[model samples]
Target: MAYTDDEILAGLAEIINEETGLETDAVQLDKTFTDDLDIDSLSMMTIAVTAEEKFGVKIPDEEVKNLVTVNDAVTYIKNAQS
Candidate 1:
């Protein structure tokens, strides 16, 4: 299956909300996970694991560091689905 960037972003926002109690709208493309969302390392791991399961993508541990913003994660998952 494939997903659009908007779908990926919405899915990611839901995951982040579930993991952090943040509002879905608060998750924007340019928002940094750490600096903007205040997501700590532990929450990031949980989000990554959940996102992998939800999106059916293998987000390797090393690659997680590269996903700095919501756009980054959405783009990664969108590409992985291809």
Candidate 2:
């Protein structure tokens, strides 16, 4: 079954929160992963890997650059699943 956007967002939230040690409530769609969440390049890659596994989608290295916010990741996974 395909996952809903909310489910994808929640999954990304968990990954971001775990990787960055940030509160889940602080993770919002509009928030910038780097500026708002303080996610470094290395940590970003880690989140990407975890997201790929959790969402069952492959996030290419080049595409990783485009995922700058929580919304971006959630959208990508939702679309990829479809």
Best-performing candidate as measured by lDDT = 1
The weakest ten consecutive residues by lDDT in model 2 span: 5-14
Relative to the true structure, how large is the alpha-carbon lDDT of every model? 0.94, 0.87
As a whole number from 0 to 100, the lDDT of residue 54 in candidate 2 is 85
Per-model TM-score versus the true fold: 0.97, 0.93
| C-alpha RMSD of each candidate structure in angstroms | 0.6, 0.9
lDDT string for model 1 (1-82, tens) is 8988999999999999999999999999999999999999889999999999999999999999999999999999998985
- Give per-residue lDDT, candidate 2, residue 39: 92
Task: Report the C-alpha lDDT of model 2 over 2-78, residue by residue, as the tens digit.
Answer: 89988887778888888887988888999998899889988999999998888788899899989888898888888
Off by over 4 Å in 2: none
lDDT of 2: 0.87
